[model samples]
Structure formats: structure tokens, C-alpha cells
Target chain A: MRYLLLVYAAAEEAAALDTRLALELAERGGLLAAHELEPVTTATSVRVRGAATLVADGPFAETCERLGGVYVVDLESLDEAIAVAARLPAARDGVVEIRPVVRREG
Target chain B: MSSVATVFREEFGRSVAVLARTLGDLDLAEDAVQDAFATAVERWPRDGAPANPGAWILATARNRAIDRIRRDRTLAGKRELLARLEREAPPAPADDDALPDERLALVFACCHPALAVDAQVALTLRLLGGLTTEEVARAFLVPEATMAQRLVRAKKKVRAAGIPIRVPPPEALPDRLRAVHATLYLVFNQGYGPPPRDELCDEAIRLTRLLAVLLPDEPETLGLAALTLLHDARRAARLDAHGDLVLLEDQDRSLWDEARIAEGRRLLDRALALCRPGPYQVQAAIASLHSDPEPDRRRIAALYDRLAELAPSPVVELNRAVAVALAEGPSTGLALLDALAEELDGYHLLHAARADLLRRLDRPGEAGEAYRRALALAPSEPERRFLAGRLHELPNGG
Candidate 1:
């Protein structure tokens, strides 16, 4: 199974996403990819409404906790994904939302 | 309570636990076991009983699960489940007769922290209480559909969240054990409350006894088992023949189960010997004292003080005041009760206790008012009747 872990944190805290942690997961063949977002200021949000395309000023909506980073990891179970999430630096000061990645496997 | 019902409850929970351990899927385990029970219901009467019902149930449920999985492999993630099932060894002939008791694992799964507390209680009852979803819903006073949805969501969360279905790791034992104890206590209390469901109480005791045996080293487990036993010891005396409430002082001593009281005292002593005091142990200790022919009220009051420190709740304080009234005087108890009035105004028992103390103090007027307040808020018929009777005893109230 694969899970997408989205870290909700301030840009400063999200900037602390651990490269060493990613490398460690990669070594274990569990890390598919992980990235810290550049910054919210340089982002644009787009939505489709009826026949019109709407563009927004920021990433989705401005909030205290922005979408700071994301990690997609392949693991056998949700517990394993949670173990990885617990290791993320952003988790110390912010929240990490874990959603099991939908897979179409035979 | 019949022969068949006894066999059904015992077999249902144990088989689900064992099968769940082997199959690694709660829904599959439960469904297959239900299917097996359905077959037994149809076939047992005509064919007579099996030599070993546990083995028979396990074998039948395993076959049903494999068939269900093989037939419905497209159900997402079940392909993995089927593949895993295929790799597992098939149940042996009569050698597989006595299934390993892995009900504790099912217990941990049902009481897993990932699920909400309400979900935890309901799941424990459904999975371990040998209760159908409808029975569980009725026990908790919820609609069957709502309870079914809650159980469904809890199982989904347990599956998707990768909550392990085995006894928790030792390092995490203390916290996990607290949750398991609390869930069981809640079940027992629900059963012990007015218009009581003796079946739920029995199930809670049955499971907690299993827990104490499995984890004998854990004092609180033994403490909880003791607590339930002590309370249940007086079951026959809780109400009159007409089902009106019977105050403890008025209850016939002959109706109390001496053997259960003795067993409860022994368990409490064992828990205390552990020297790791907990709220359950204290509660059990109080119950043991109450069971004594000549209970020491002073000690009961002091234990309640300790209980307040341990649990820190208004309920404990209210109990303490009752003990104080018996130990000290009605005036002293009444003063303590008055302090708790604002905090426990919503609790009918507090008002009832206050009325009793006031009546003892010869203040019929205040006692009548308190009794009326209690009668207004008492949650059940017997309790209301008891309070009304007390109100009529008051000079002004009559």
C-alpha cells in the first residue's frame, strides 16, 4: 500500500522537512517521493466551475497552517505510514495528515 | 440462558477471535463466523451436536472465508488477503479441535485507540459480548442503524489505519491497559444501571475474568474483575420483588452472594499486594468493605477520599459524603453535600443522598424539597418510586 502524507505547517517549519529522513526511507525501499513546497507566495490555485476556470491568489486558501510538504511512501500498512509520519520534523510543531493513496492493483 | 444460547455466546466470541487472528481481517472473521452459526442453527438440531463445537466452528468459518475471498477477489485489497490466506496452513483434522484463545487480540482491536471511545465500547460488545449489532444497540439505547454504521466505520478505521489486532506491545501496555479496563467498566456500568441488562453484566464479567487470567500480573485487571464481582454479588438485593429500589442498608444480608464477596475480597487483596494503587483497586476495596458483616465506615470514608485523589470527579466526592454521613454524622455529611449542590445539581442521586441526610437531621421541610427535586430528575422508575416514598415520610410532605 501507498500513503500520501501531507504536512500542514508554517513555511518555516515545512522548510525543515528532513532530506536525511527521505534518504533513510529510500534506503528501505519505502520512499517513493517527498518534497517541501517552495513557498506559498509563489503559488497559484486553480478551480473549474461549470464552464469557467477560476484562478486564486494563493495556494488554495490562506490559513495559519499551509500545505508545507508532501510525502508519498509505499508501505505494507497504515501503521507503517504513521511510523514514518511520526518521524517527520514538521510533525513536532504542526500536523501531518495521512490518507491512504488509492491503488488499482490486481 | 438455554443450552443452545450458552453454547452460541461462548462459541461466537472465541471463534471470531481465533479466526480473526488467523485471517487478519475482522469483517471476514465476523462474517464467516456468523455464516457458520447460521449453518449450526439449521443443521445442529437435525444432526445433533459436534464432538468439539469450537473446532467445528473454526473449520466451517475458515472454509466460508476462503470461499468468500476466492469468489470476491475484486473487492479492493482482498486480493492480498486471499493470497495471504492461501499461504496459511489449513486447519488440521481433530488436532485443530481446541483453537488457541486469541480473544485478547480481538479485544485490543475492538478497543484500539484509533477508534472513537463510543465506537470502542460498541465494538467490544458486538465482537466480544456475543451480541448481535441489534442487541448491542438496544443495550446502549441507540438505533440499530446508527450502531451498525458505527461498527462499520470502526472496522474500516481498524483496517485502513493499520491498527494492530494483537495484544499491544509491552512498552505501550500501561496506557493500552487503562483503555481496555475503562471500556469494560463502562460496559459493566451500563449493565448494572437501572432496568438492568443482566446479560451485559455477565458478558462484561466473563470478558474481564478472561483478561485477568491472561494478564495476571496486571493488578488493575484483577481489580476491575473484583469490582464487578462485588457489585454483582448483591444483584438479587438491588430491587424488591415488585422491582422497587432497595437501599443497601435495607437489603437482606442473606441475598448477598458470600462466595462472590469472598472472591472479590481475595482479588482486591491481590491487587493491593501489587502495591501499585489505582482507582479500580480503591473502588474494589470499598466494595469489599461494604460486603463485610461489620463494615468500618471510617475506612470507607477514607477510601473515598483516596478515590477522589485518584479519579478526581464529583461522583467520587458524592460517594465520599455518603460514607462520611455513616462515619461521622448526618449534619457533617449534609454540609459536605451542600458544597457539592452546584456541581452535582444535575445528578439525581446527589439530591436523593441530600434528602436522606436531611431527613436524618430531622429537618423534614428541607428533606421534602430535596426528595421532590430527586423525584423530578431520577432517571428510572424504581429510583423515582424510592424518592417519592421518602418524600411521603416527611411531615410536611405528607
Candidate 2:
């Protein structure tokens, strides 16, 4: 199974993380891919209405904790995904939502 | 005589647990076991009981489950898993000792911390107690549909989250053990409460005993078993012939089970010998004190003092005050009760205890008022009747 770990953290908490630490954590967690998002200030939100595409300024919603990074990892079970999510530094300061990726093929 | 009902009660948990292990699906295992039991109820009387009822049920349940899996087109993706189970399904164990006893694992899984406490209790009863969804819903006073959805969601989480259907490792045992203990305690209390369900109590005790065997070195496990046994020993004296509440002092000590009391005391001794005084051990100790022919009120008071330090709560303080009243005097207990008034205003037992102390001190007026307050808050008929009786005893018939 594959899970998308959406890492959210306070701005300052996300800033404090060095590349070395992030890489180390990703390696330890068996992360297939890890991407640190740009600051929430640079985010552009998009939504699809009945027949029109709506655009918004700032992130999807205003919140103290912002989506700071994401990790895509393959694991045997949701328990393993949770374990990996707990390892993310952002999880200490904010939240890491683990969502199983729907497999298109059986 | 072996009846289908007796066989169902004895074999339900064992069959479900073993089937779950083989099928790797709790819901399917439960369904299969239910079907097997239903079939037994229909066929047993006409055919006479099977030579080996447990094995018969297991084999029938297994065959039924495999057939269901094979026929369900929606489970096409799981064809490989189903095929594996079909090939590897072993015959049921010949003896009780050989039985898989997967209930321990099922309990741990059901009580996993990821699920809400309410959901955990419901799942434990449904899965381990072999209760129907409606029965569980009725127990918790929820609608059948609501409970069905809750169980579905919880089971989905268990499967999706890959909560292992096995005991946790030693390092993680402490935290997981608390959840497991809390569920078992809730089960036992439900059965021990008014309009008691003896079967639930028996199931809880049996499961807790299994837990004790599985965790032999864990003092708290043994403490819990002791606490349950000690309390259950007094079951015969807990209520009157009419099922009204009977206070401890008013209960006939002769009615208490001496064998169970001795067993409880032995377990308590073992738990205490571990030199680890946890909440359950403290509670068992208090029960032990209460069981004595000539109970030492002063010693019980002192133990309550220790317990307050270990796990302080309003309920404990209320109990401690009652012990102090016996050890010291009514006035002293009254003072402690007064301090807890605001904190425990909504609690009927606190009010009842206060009323008792007040009455003992010859303050009939205040005692009457307290009794009224307790009567208003008391939920059960027996408890309300007991309080009303107390009120009627007041001067001028409060």
C-alpha cells in the first residue's frame, strides 16, 4: 500500500528544519518522495465550480498551521504509514494526515 | 445435558476467534459463527447433540464461510486470500488446551487506542461477547442503526490501519494494557450494575483470567482479576429477595462465597508481592478489608489515604470519607463530605453518603434534604428505592 503523508506545521517550525534533517527523516521513513512546499504566502488555491474554475488568493484556508511538506511512501499497512508519519518532525509541532492512495490497478 | 444454548455460550468466542484468524476478517468470522450457531439451534434437538459439538460447529462455520467467500463476486480482489484460507484451514483442535484462544488477540484489537472508548466497548462486547449489534446498541442505549454504523466504521479502521490481531510487544504493553483493562473493567461494571447481566460478568472474568495467564508478570493484570473476583464473591448478598439494593453492613456475610473470597485474597497477595501498588491492587485491598469478619475501619481508612495519593478522584474521596466515618466519627465524615459538595453535587452516591453521615449525627433535617437530592439523581430503581427507604426513616417521615 502507498500513503500520502500531508505534513502541516507552523511557519517558524517549518523554517527551522535544515535540508540534512529532512533528508535523514525521509530516508529513515522509507519515503519514496518528499517535497517541502513553498511558504503559504506563495500558495494559489483553485476550485472547480459547476462550469467555471474559481481561484483564490492565499492557501485553501487560513489556518495557523500550514501545509509545509508532503511525503509519498509505500508501506505494507496503515500502521506502518502512521509510524512513518509520527517520525516526521512537523508532526511534533502540527499534524500529519495519512491517506491511503487509491490503486488504479488491482 | 448438553443443549445448543450451552454449546453456543461456551464455543462462540472460541469459534469466532479461530475463524477470524483463518479468514483474516473479523466481520466475516462473526457472521460465519453466527450462522453456525443458528444452524446448531435448528438441528441439534432433532438430531441429538453432536459427539464433538465445538468441532462440528467450527467445521460447519469454516465450510459456510469459504462458500460465502467463493460466491461473493464483490470479493473478487480477495480471491487469492480466500483460496489460501481454503487450502490451509486446519481442523478444529481436539481439546480445550489446543483451542486457539484468539479471544485475547481479538480483545487487544478491539480495544486499540485508535478507536473511541465507546466504540472500543461496543466492539469488545460484539466481537468477544458474541453479542448482536442490536444487543450492543441496547446495552449502550443507542439506536440499532447507529451502533451498526459505528461497528462498521470501527472495523474498517482496524482493517485499514492494519491493527495487528495479536498482543503488543513488551515495550508498548503498558499503554495498550490500560486500554484493554479499561474495556474489561467497563464490561465487568456493566454486568455488576443494577439489572445485572451475569453472563457479561462471567465473560469479563473469563477474559481477564486469560489476560492474567498471558501477562503473568504484570501485577496490574492480576490485581484486576483479584478485584473482580472479590467483588463478584458478594453477588449473592448485593441485593434483597425483591432485588432492592442492600448496603454492605446490611448484607448477610454468610451469603458471600468463601471460595471466591479466598481465591481473590490469594490473587491480591500475589499482586502485592510484586511490590507494585497500582490502582487495581489498591481497590482489591479495600475490597479485601471489607470482606473481613471484623473489618479494621482504621486500616481501611489508611489504605484509602494511600489510594487517594495513587489515583485521586472525587469518587475515591467520597469512599475515603465513608471509611473515615467508620474509623473516626460521623462529624469528621460530614466535614469531608461537605468539602466535596460542589464537586459531587450531581453524583447520587456522594449525596447518599452525606445523608447517611448526617443522619448518624442526628441531623435529620439536613439528612432528609440530602436524601431527596440523592433520590432525584439516582438512575436505577433499586438505588432510588434504597434512598427512598432511607428518607422514610427520617423523623416526620422525610
Candidate 3:
């Protein structure tokens, strides 16, 4: 099973992270297949209509924290995924929300 | 009260859940079960613990339900609902089968996300912990009416939204469990921290123990229990004879509860052995570092670094700032705390940390500003006073 780990953080705090070291740790743990997003200056959320995506300036839900990054991790079970998730530097007081990715045309 | 009444009260929850399953309407199920228990309490002393106590309760409940259905003119349309309930609620052979999923169902139902966070906590404590609204209110330092309204509204939302009474599917369990664990943690934290209400702390511990029992296989659950125990182990040492905030490093090592710390450490080790790293497990790992008699700030800083990466947030960063202060120096931590202040404007601990860092840097003016901010945002009397005391040390504290 594959899960998406959403990393949330304040912008400055996100900037101070040891991205290289984090990636190294993830790679050693086989969680390296995940992608790193460029820190976004702007975020626009969209909802699809009949033929259009209605874009808005931030997320659909506004929170103090923003989605700092995301990781697409493959693991055998939620337990294993959680283990990997726990190791992510992002799971402290800030949360790393883990949701299973839904496959289209599976 | 008689033995039957005691039994009825003890089994009230199981009876309610069983009845709810049979009746398919929570309100009706609750009334009928209460009526059954009432009858049992009145008759059981005279009748003795029935050969099958469940059957006696079920029989009484069914008959009472039937009478209510027949008597309520407006509920004539609900005859099918009533009949179905009565049919399903047959006399139990032993009553042991009555609530197979009673505790679980109640917990899940109470923890439904449709309700607000406060509502979830209040409802869970009420339904599973068997606590009254007044008791919960007192535990939370809120008024009974406020808590009562919160529970009432929560139940209404659960019924109105048709929230199911089952633990979410495997995929959904993590998030749901997070919420449930959070509510439980909050309860425990409330108990273990300020006001020093030992009973509420014990109640929260009891509730978490139940959760630990239910989800023994989940390392996160065990982690939560362990984290609670670890923090709780030092509860007595957190305050002094003068009732001041005692920093972890400054706390008297002898005052810490070795037994509780040992249990917590064991649970944390077991959780780590499972290699299932979730939020709770990560938090537990942090707590485990603190549980040491002579905690290594560098090791704790490394764990915080991993934790900050695993769960990046302002709060984590704030914690890492403290760890950095310990592992590196107050100056190194000051930079991190300053950066955190931009986004964590209203967070009390951020200001407190900033103040501490400033004080260490000998920047008295800035430290006073930070202390004022902390005092402004402090959530409790003790915290406010502590911040105020820190400010008093600053030149011309305004």
C-alpha cells in the first residue's frame, strides 16, 4: 500500500529543516521514493466544476500551518507506514497527516 | 442501594448498547434500558440475582417498550421500530452476549468526528468513563452547565448526522485513533498538570488503560499510555513546596516516581520494538528521553531533530529550540526561537522560550517583552504568575 504523508510547518521552521539529512534518512529507510515540493510562495486550491477548476488563494481550509511538503511512501501496512511516518522529522507537535492514496483505474 | 441496583449501575452501559443495537433508535433504547435497570433494582433484592439476569432485564425492557409504543399516540408510526427492537431484544441465555461490542461501540460513537473536539472529549468521558457531566466539567475546570450543553449537543449531532457506532475501517482508524488518543491524552494531561487534581488524573489514566487494553496490538496506543505514564511519573516533582513551576532539569530527581517511570519505559520499549512509528510513538520516544534520571540533552536534541523532521510544526520547533538551548547553547536556541516567534505569535510557550533564551543572552529588555507576551498568553494562573515573576526580574517591568 502507498500512503501520502503531508508535512505541515510554519514557513521559517520549514526553512531551517535539514532537508539533505532528512532525505538521507528516508533513503536509508527505503522511504526515499517520496517527492520533495519546492517551498511554495503561493498556494491555490481548486474545486472542479463541470468543465473548470475554481481556484482560490490558499487551501480549501485555512489553518495556521500550511502543507510544507509531501512524501509518497510505499509500505506493507499502516503499522509500517506509521513507523516510517514516526521517523519523519515532521511528526512532532506539528502533524504529518497520513492518508492512503487512491488509485484511479485500478 | 441493593446489590441489584449496584449491578444495574455497573452494567448500565452494556445494557444501553445492547438495547440500542436491538432498538435501532438510541433514544428509545436508552429509555427502555433505563426502565429495565430501574425494574431490576426495585425487584432484584426481592427476586434475587435472576437465574439469567440479562433475561430478566431484557424481559422487563421489552414489556416496558411495548407498553410505551402502545401508549404514545403520536408514535403509532414507530410500531415497526418498536416491534423490531422487542424482537431483537430477546431474553438472554446468560446476558454475557448482550454487549459484545459495548465499550468499543460507545467509544467509537462518542469519538465521532462530526462533533466538535470538546464534545468528543466530554462524550467519551461520559459514556466510557461513566462520569457525570458535573464530574467531567469539574475535571476540565469548566462549569457543569457548559459541559452538559456540550454533551447534549454532541449527542444531537451524532443522532442527526447518523454517525455509525463502529470503529472506522482500517484505513480510517489511524486518524480516528489520533483524535481518540488526543482526547484521552488531553484528559490525562489535564489530570497530571495544574490544579493538581489527582482524581481526574487517575480517571484519565484509567480511561487510557482501557484504550490500551482494547488496542493492545497498536504501538501508538501503547505509546500514548507510556507517554502519559512517563510524564505523570514526575507529577509530584513538577511543583515545589511554594507551588512554583519546576523546570525538568531543575526538578528533584528523588521526587520522581521510579515505579511509574519503569512501567512507562517498558511500554515505550515495547512500542519501539514493534517498529510502528506513529505520532504517539514519536512523542513517547521524546518522553522516554526525559524519563532518564540524568537525561542527555544532546541525545534528546537528536531525537527532537528527528521528531521535528517527522512532525514539523511550530510547536515541535519550539520544543527543538529548548533542546537546542540544552545541546548547543542559549545563543544557538535564540535564533530558532526568534524564527518561531513570527508564526507562533499567540503561543505562550514560544514567548516563554524566547524569554528564557533572551535571559540567557543577557538581553534583559527583550526578555521582558517576551515575558509580557508569555504572561498575556498564559492559559492558567500558575503559568501567568510564573511569567510575571520572570518579568519582575527585568529592569522596570511594565
Candidate 4:
């Protein structure tokens, strides 16, 4: 199984992922990919209508917590994914959303 | 109990857990288990009960699930599962005793932290408790459709979020088990009043027993078993002949279930021997003390103090005040209650306790006011009547 951990943080707070935890996850072959996203100011939202494509600036929603980073990990279960997410430094000061990665082939 | 109902209670969780482990799908496993029970409910009486009910149900459920997969071969994402299930060995005989008791795994998955507490409870009841959606709704005092939706949503989350059906590792065991215990405790508490829902309490205690056995060394598990058993032992004595709520002080001690109390004490002793005193163990200790012919008030008060320290809740504080009043004096308890007046302003029991203490202290007027507040805030007719009866006994008809 695989999960995408979407890290969210306030605009002013720089959410830092723990390097040791990230290294351990990678070493254990659980961490597939990890990256910090550009701030919400650099986000571009797009919507497709029947014939028109509407483009907007900033993140998708005007919320205090903005999407800051993401970690894609292959794990045994959602609980394991959550355990990994909870070890992240940002989890203490922000929120981490876990979404299962759809498997095209088993 | 009817043989069918008895079989369902004993075998549902085991069958579903084994099925889910083999099938890798909680939703399918639950549906299959339900189908198996429905079949048993219809057939067992006419066909005569099977020798080994659990094995009978498991074999039947596995066969039906395979048949369903064969019938619905067009469904997407099931082809792989169907192939895998087909490659497995043929179904065993009904009397086969090799059925894996994986109910603890099922319980853990149902009580997963990702789900909301209510959802966890509903799922546990509907799946592990062998309860129908309507029965679960009635237990929770919600509409059937609401509970149905909740079950569907919870099952969907269990699938979509990939919450695996298995026991947690050692490090996560305590926290995960705590969640499981909370749901069971809630089920028992919900069964506290109504006779019709008393089965919920029985089911909760039954599951707690299973947990204690499956994880024999977890002192908290043992403590929870002790707590539920101890509380249940006093169920028969909680109300008077007039169907009125009986206060602990006024209840007939002879009515208590001595056997259950003895078993609870044994469990508590085991928990204490572990030297890992948690909230449930502390509360169970208090209940154990209360079960005594002449309860040691000071010891009970000391246990309450430990409980307050462990849990740190206003309700615990309130109980501690009562225990303190029992051990020390009403005036001391009254002083403690005064400190919590602001925090527990709306709690009826707080007012009731205050009223009791004031009445004992001979402050009839203050006691009258507190009794009136408690009466006004009382949630049920029995509680209101109990408070009113207390007031009626007061001087000047307070």
C-alpha cells in the first residue's frame, strides 16, 4: 500500500520535516518521494468549464493552513503511514493529511 | 438465548475477522458474515443446530463469498481477488475446528483511530457485536437510516483509507487498545438504564473479556474487564422495587452479584500485580472497594485521588469530593465542591452532591436551593424523581 501525506502549515510558519525520520523512512524503503511545495502565493488555481478555463491566483481555498509539502510513501497500512506522518516536525505545529495512493496494478 | 442468536454472538466476529484477513476486504468480510448469520437464523431451527457453530458459519460464509464473486465477475478490481480466492484450498467440513480466532484483529480495525469515535462504536456493534443496523440505531437512539449511513461511510473509509485489519505493534498497542476500551465502555454506559438495551452492556463486557484473554498481559485490558464486570455486578441493585433509581448508600447489598464481583476482584488483582496502574485500573480499584461489605471509605477516597491524578477530569473531581466526604466530613467535601462550582455549573450531579453535603451539614436552605437546581437540570424522570424525593425529605419541604 501507498499513501500521500499532505502537509499543511500557516503562511508565516516554515514547516520543517525531520531529516533523521526522513532518512530512516528512506532507508526502510518506505519513503518513495518527498518534496516541499512553494508557498501558497506561488500557487495557481485552474478550473475547466465547458469551453472556458478559469485561472486564479493563490491556493485553492483561503484558509489559515496552506498546503506546504507532500510525502509519498509505500507502507503496510494507513496506520503505518500515520505513524510516519506523526514523526514529522510539522505535525506538532501544523496538520498532515493522509490520502491513499490509488494502485493501478497490484 | 436462541441457538441462532447464540451462534451469531459467538461466531460473527471470528468469521468476519478470518474472512477479512483472507479476503483483504473488511466490507466484503462483514457482508459475507451478515449473510452467513441470516442464513443460520433461517436454517438452524429447522435443520437442527450445527455441532460446531463457529466452523459452520465460517465455512458457509467463505462459500457464499466465493459464489458471490463468481456471480459478479464483471465488477472491476475484483478479478484479482476472485482469482486469488479461487486458487485457495477447497472449503472444509462444517465440523472443522481449525477456524482462526482473529476477532481481536477485527476489533482493532473496527476501533481504528482514523474513524470517529461514534463511527468506531457503530462499526464495532454492527460487525463484531452481531447487531443489525436497526438494532445499533436503537441502541444509540438514532434513526435506522442514520446508523446505516454511518456504517456505510465507516466501511468505505476502512476500505478507501487502507486501514488494515490486524493487531497493532507493541509500541502502538497501548494507545490503540485505549481507543478500543473507550468504545466498549461507551457501549456499556449506554446500556446503563434501559432493560431492552441491557444486551449492549453484556456484549460490551463479552468483548472486553475477549480482549483481556487475547492480550492477557496488558494490565489496562484486565483493569477494563474488572471495571465493566464490577459495574455489571451491581446492575440488579441499582434500582429499587418501585423502579426508582437507588442511591449506592440505600441499595440492598445482598442484591449484588457476588460471583461477578469475585471475578472482577481477581482481574483487578492481576492488573495490580502488573504494577501498571492506569485510569481503568484505578476506577476498578474504587469499584472493588465499594463492593466490600463495609467499604473502606478512606481507601476508596485515596483511590479516587489517584484516579483524579490519572484522568484529571471534573467528573472525577466530583466523585473524589463525594469519597472525601465519606472518608472525612461533609464540610470538607463541601469546601472542595465550592472550588469546582464554576467549572461544573451545569452538571446536575455536582448540584446533587452539594445538596447532599449541605443537607448533612444542617444548612437546609442551601441544600434546598441545590436540590432545586439538581431537580431542574436532571435529564431523566428517574433522576428528577430521586432528587425530588430527596427534597421532599428536607425540612419545610425543600
Badly placed stretches (over 4 Å) of model 1 are: A4-47, A55-97, B1-4, B77-80, B90-98
Give per-residue CA lDDT, model 4, range A1-106, as digits (tens): 8899988875545764667888999999999988888778899999999999999997778877778888889998898898998888777778889999877642
Per-model DockQ against the true two-chain complex: 0.42, 0.37, 0.02, 0.52
lDDT of 1 by residue, B1-398 (tens): 12345578787888888778766778988999899888888878878867667677777887899889878846666766767766755556466444677888889888876679999998898887779999988888899999999999988887766677788678667888898998999899989988788988988999898898888878999999999999999999999899987888889989998988988888888888999999999999999888888999999999999999999989899999999999999999988999999999999999999988988988888888888899899999878888888898788763
TM-score of chain A of each: 0.88, 0.77, 0.67, 0.89
Q: In model 3, how well does chain A match by TM-score?
A: 0.67
Model 2 per-residue lDDT tens digits across residues B266-360: 98899999998899999999999999999999999999999999989999999999999999999998899899999999999999999999899
Winner on TM-score between 2 and 4 is 4
Give the Å shift of residue A37 in candidate 3: 38
Residue range B133-231, candidate 3, lDDT tens digits? 788899888989999888778776555444666666797788888778888887787776665777667767766767787788889888888888888
Q: Write the per-residue lDDT of candidate 4 for residues B180-210, one digit (tens) a residue.
A: 9999998888888634267888989999998
For candidate 1, the per-residue lDDT at B232 reads 94
TM of chain B, each: 0.93, 0.90, 0.82, 0.94
Native-contact recovery for every candidate? 0.46, 0.25, 0.00, 0.58
Better of 1 and 3 by lDDT: 1
The docking category that best describes candidate 3 is: incorrect
What DockQ was computed for model 3?
Answer: 0.02
Better of 3 and 4 by lDDT: 4
Kindly indicate the candidate among 1 and 3 with the higher DockQ: 1
lDDT of 4 at B30: 84
Candidate order by lDDT, decreasing, is 4, 1, 2, 3
